[model samples]
Target: MLTVYAYQKCSTCRDALKWLRDRGIPHEVKAIRETPPTVAELESVLSGTGGDIRKLFNTSGVDYRELGMKDKLPTMDQAAALELLSSNGNLVKRPFVTGDGKTLVGFKESDWAAALG
Candidate 1:
């Protein structure tokens, strides 16, 4: 099953969920703010994103800035980055979705079509 981790108040997240529903895509939604993805899961997503750890971060998020991840990320290893992401959903990008051996971050309609189609 497709698993979508999203923040309830995020407009992007809401739109992504609506898009899925409109397409009749089978998926399960999780409240990301309450239950962040585990370290193992982040690892899988990183692999799917071509090993780009930065793709997992919510660059515009308050937590990302407050924690000073911008400069810290360059010095941190993938393990450390994943650990940080697992600790706070707000720091991670919204509408993170994975299923059928595919992983995706954010919601781009064309990308979703290619992945799910």
Candidate 2:
């Protein structure tokens, strides 16, 4: 089963969940704001995105802006960045899904279909 870390208030998260349900894809949903992904999971996503750590972030989020991640990210090392993200779920992208050796960020229907299918 896939594990999806999503915020309830996020429309994108809702959409992703709906898509999964519509397809009958087995998955577990966790509130991203309360339970962020672990470093290991983040690492998997990092690897999946070809070592682009920025892809793992919710760059448009308030937390991202307030924390100055955009300016700070370039100077931060992988370990430090992952630690910060793991500690604060708000900094993570919505609809973070991981399972079956696959990792996906955000809610792109086509991407999800291709990955989960």
| Tens digits of per-residue lDDT for model 1, 18-114 | 9989999899999998999889888888988889999999999999899999999999998889988999999889899877787889999899889
lDDT value for model 2 = 0.94
Instruction: Quantify all predictions' global Cα lDDT against the true fold.
Output: 0.91, 0.94
At residue 11, give the lDDT of candidate 2: 98
lDDT of 2 by residue, 1-117 (tens): 899999999999999999999999999999998999999999999998999999999999999999999999999999999999999999999889999888999999999989988
**Estimated TM-score per prediction?**
0.96, 0.98
Deviation from native of the Cα of residue 35 in model 1, angstroms: 0.5
